[model samples]
Target: MKNYFLEISFLLFLLTFSSLKAQTYARNGMVVSDNKLASDAGVQILKRGGNAIDATVATAFALAVTHPAAGNIGGGGFLVYLPENGQATTIDFREKAPLASSPTMFLDENGKLVPGSNHDSIKAIGVPGTVAGMFLAHKKYGKLPWSDLLSPAIQLAKTGFPLTWALYNEGNYHYTNNSTEFLKNYFIKDDGSMTSFGEVWKQPELAKTLEWIAKKGQDGFYKGKIASQIDAFMKANGGLITTQDLAKYQAVERAPIHGTFNGYDIYSMPPPSSGGVTMTAMLNFIEQANAEEIPFNSTAYTHLMIEAMRRGYADRAEYLGDPDFNLEMPLNLLTSKDHAIARFKNFDKNKASVSDSTSFGHPYDGENTTHFSVVDREGNAVSVTYTLEQSYGSGLGDPELGFIFNNEMGDFNAVPGETKSNGQIGTDPNLIAPEKRMLSSMNPTIVAKDGQPVLVMGSPGGRTIINTVFQAVLNTILYDMPVDESIEAMKIHHQWLPDVTYYERNKMSPDTVRALEAMGHEMIPVGQLGRLMGIQFFPKDGVYFGASDSSSPDGAAVGY
Candidate 1:
């Protein structure tokens, strides 16, 4: 009887412990996302003792499989890393212009802006850099072998994964207007109904490509059979990308743009991407506002931030561009404390500032993008942001290769006007040039405390990237909120274009909206705010916490 009772007690204890563990947060780490599997992959890597960069590489590959509509292997981006040694680095692997590109490519015979075709094979391409960038990051900081890190994505792609409601909606929205053969094969049913959530989606070709990459590293894509295949596809489809473009593609490692925000060292990507400079300038301006004392979401706080956004965006439009080409751009505009303070003097508390009135000549064009953040047990951090320029990326995909190309050429401004005070001509330095990279707005940032990394943050939304990062940093460091709440809170964006204040509905306070309206501001309800991802470290416990954007269907943070 005694033996039987002990056995029963042991069984009961085991059951109770299992239940408690299930109810509790994942202590090995947490990965929150719209797509649970993608998050799970990251958590798995962390559990296996891979560093943050390795986990990030795994998560990115998983995203490419499960969240194909947004996450992609054919795209390029920026990666910001803050190692435990206190060295911050940024890898600028953004897409590059094709060798055939020209500054006037987007202009018509009459010198007017041409209407861009969303499906022109010739215009749908850029030199992709994601593979190179990921490989470089892994080589530098990854704990796991490249093959092991890629296994999850390969399995998911080959065996298939279930689609979420968000993927269904986005796929339907993107493919609804025109049913191309490619769309029919991948996304649509015979009756033209979009594939619904819970349906299994597979990409055998992507799986094969991933397998090749795993075996051969970046060489498999850039100079091997994959490059040959891409060259053939582009040539046959009237695209300008050539094998030379692929063979010559390189991911440049650059020094991170650094700034001090309330004593925390902020690091982000530099030129060819305006995110770093613009973000630094905005934060510098806000630092002077003494924002810590203001109530969270108060009218005063919102007004000050909105005004500062206006100033920062104005600078982004007039003074920022591809540094290799734009030699006249006032680099001092962001680094000089005096210039940042001088710009702040123009902010008016009671009125919206007109962008053109405040800044010098020539407005520039922009593009859309995506961002993700990762942190590991060893304190290595990575914030990566990439894009295809626009939704569906010119709506052209190579069926054989199973990937769409980026339409980054449209990012350049078509019309050039008078020179600005910063010394640039009516021509945008970002104007398309042969083999020149288009200017991007992707900002991947890492924040350090006392020379050690404490936060890794970034966002995706064209001109809004800077503003989103600015707000999230303030929310996390100054407002003192957890990562999840800081990202979930309502957000506002003012890009100094059309001079309108765009706010996410039901996110910001009602009083804040009213205050902006009273200040002669035009308010528009935006369906969604920018997506942000961040990780915060707790020095006392030596544990790191991460959060993805609540607005994203697949934003997740996984730690171990």
Candidate 2:
């Protein structure tokens, strides 16, 4: 009887393993973001037999309607796609420098640096490319009809969406001190208070624009009435974007950055994004450290991760730039085993490394951006990262189209400096050269095993994008946690500046914090960390599970 019981137990173990593997099916899909309706809209597309590319286009269109404060048709972004048989590809649709923009545009008459260029329409706006990128992705791999994918966004824009607490709060925070008449009339309530949560906000003009695009295809915006309006508005407002810029824009398809972690293939956006190199460097350094042996979330693990972040960020500040303009970076800096071994040689358990020691190189400018991940029924996956440069973009919107413009010009270094040996300058590589794309920190990534996608994830946090993605992957892979729990876990970030480590309040253990403090580290409690979205597949059973950040008001993972 004892022997029989043992045999039964062994059978049960095999069944459990089989169940886990069987859960990975083509039909499983997930969408996550700061808006619930948008996330649901993407999942709906997935449920309707759309592949990951279709779902991404759908979600992106919906976000342009529902989350106008952060996403829009006026911005630009990067798209990373992984097909079943080939290497991943990255689409660079990042906003470009406007024709009127010059290297000295932000400099004062006295040659002094000027602050707040991010808020100026003349200095803020870039040639928008969001629409072009979406259309391009759809053209290449989307299975659903483009018009069908656009219908959901059109409905949301025409009928309006109720404001969530998060949206209401953020709007109030950003618009409180605005003195512009245009913003006051559009975003503020009648009684001098910001619009409250639950209020229905309708964007009729945007609805019409989306509808036009649905009917006319890509030409709807680039060459039709919308383009004319955008050109006229920029001309009137002293901005540089013209109808020609819109008509000339095209999304470039480039090779995706490839790396490996514990036999899983990792793919992400390459330059002009710092995400690929920085994330790989951190992960490579950690791999050399044998970080898995440290207790998960323990002070030692946290400390080492932060140290790695510091080194990676320092490298980012010195060596990263637009590859189109700069000489090819030593890609080996992040992929070489010898380089990883050398980086880990400086690891010290009890003291913080000086910035100068890690800051041996000079990278280019970093800018604001956001990311989203999607997986659909056909086993295809896409990770897209989009941005308007900064919040409210250039703080200028084409009055007629109801869209904000991108302030991508601030991504250029305004200071005059000599070019480095690698042909990178602190200033010009990402500067206001005609049609040059700005450098970004948006990193969207996918993890595949045995040539099939196993995980999809990305985040929105400007310079912290790499750190957020790296930690989440560690949680899911090294720590062996569920997708939801892994994303929900508290996160810490170190940007190699101000010489302090930032932590999310009340999420990390007090013991961990105490241990780091004792190790001569300065720690500050940050209220919230960057928002992350992810989905994991159980290959054996063909089931997909999704997870989103809990701190976000509207993020969700819905699976049938």
Candidate 3:
């Protein structure tokens, strides 16, 4: 009887693990985000007959209340929308420098970076773009009322939700590390102390704020009461943003960057975001090399990937920037097939290329972020990756407004022509300038076949975001990896500087690590690289399969 019980327990464990690896399938709609509650909020919209764009808007708002670590109204990011019928487009609501900002805003008199000024101070905050982006997206593509779409999030804020282990840690971080009097307000804990696991967290102030947006739409935040409050807050503090900055912020609708890889059509965000251009270039290189024949994570395969990343990121640092600011950007030349092939032609598969000193080709190029993907019954897909720069952002929240401000100014190259070996770039393209949007790695992408989206996905990993999204595309289209495996696969990151390939600890075999190091490449081990959320469409069965990366303890893929 004891042996029989042991056998049953073993079988149960196997079944549980298998189920976790399997996709969550649905017939009409699917929403996948880093937080289960946020995914449920998206599905809630779909249940009310909302389309993909509407569902995504709901999800983004819900994340603002649930995933406080990254999801934010005080931050900004990119959005890629692939409607079933209309032309594919992207919304660039990325945060911009305030009018009072300058190139040397974060520098001292001696031209050195001010300690913690760029990332942890009021000076680091930019004009937020998330609310503007969401409103613009819904204004163009939404079927449901804007207020109705935000109902779920407002409800979550008004009542409360159980605190998860992940949120507990984040709140503790904010509660402990909060420095100034302005930043001392707790994340969601009204009692001013971190909550225990499973404790309910309610934000009455946030509910009132959402109610304003619900009633007045975009004007609710940027024009009237909220704007006045922000102006007053900044005046009381030392922040650069003012009522004029908030009132003038607008999200631009741009044509999506389109590319083809392995017969799969790809649509992604354009300039200011290095994602699409760099990812397309790297994908083009991998395709030209016929990398499919090489074993995954093998020494040759790893070398090929690193070389592609090296060249792509080098170009990114030199050329890409906000299109409105930088007119000389050679976006076409950088993403062209010829450019990719030339960049890869001299590659030696057995040897890794040096990435220490990066120089740009005549053609040119270009943070924490969160991503959620939504697909409705109509075949429309929306991919969004938004963030507050660093987790919890500036850690400063006005108790009355109840939202954290983003420190996105740190994304800028604080010093000119001062690139470093520790992954800091001081290139001209990304230099700080007033009213300019900072360049980003946030690339929300969709892959379609025969003009129908088959994959909707993206990730958040600061500099590693592009590479992580790049592999997700390759894993699905090139490798035929399962939906879950495509996101859960071992990932590596290589930016042009630092020249080190950072791998997830213990994810790769020791033999492969040694082989890679023998190829004259520096390798370092780190913790998890990204938390990816994605959905795979199987048109033959009229089914959608959603998968959230296991790295997010509370993450779930909700479908119906």
Highest lDDT, which number? Answer: 3
Predicted candidate 2 versus true structure: per-residue lDDT over 1-560, tens digit per residue: 37998899999999965433322123466666556687778888888888878888888988887666557788887888988766789888887777666766776897555777634546577788888889988998888899989988888878877877877776766677653445544554446566678987776777888888988878898898999998898788777888888888887888888888878888988888878778888888889878778988788888998899888876676666667777767766665657777888988977777654323433332344556778766678888878776665666776568767777777665544533333233444455567777777788888889988888888777666778888888788788876777777878988776467889999888887888988878889988777787888878878777766765556665555
Model 2 lDDT at residue 488? 70
Provide C-alpha RMSD values for all models, in order: 7.2, 7.6, 2.5
lDDT of 1: 0.73
Model 3 residue 360 CA deviation (Å) reads: 5.6
- Two-way TM-score contest, 2 vs 3, winner: 3
Q: Where is model 3 more than 4 Å wrong at Cα?
A: 1-16, 19-22, 176-184, 187-193, 358-367
Give each model a TM-score.
0.88, 0.88, 0.96
Clashing pairs in 1: 29-559, 31-557, 32-556, 32-557, 34-553, 34-554, 417-426
Per-candidate clashes come to 7, 19, 5
lDDT of each: 0.73, 0.75, 0.86
Error of 3 at 208 (Å): 0.6
Against the true structure, candidate 3 reaches a TM-score of 0.96
Model 1 CA deviation exceeding 4 Å by range:
1-34, 117-121, 172-176, 188-196, 357-368, 418-427, 509-511
Residue 301 C-alpha lDDT in model 2: 85
Residue 526, model 2: lDDT of 86
Q: After superposition, how far is residue 145 of candidate 2 from its true place, in Å?
A: 2.2
Candidate 1 residue-wise lDDT, 421-450, digit = tens: 432334466667777777777888888888
- lDDT for model 3: 0.86
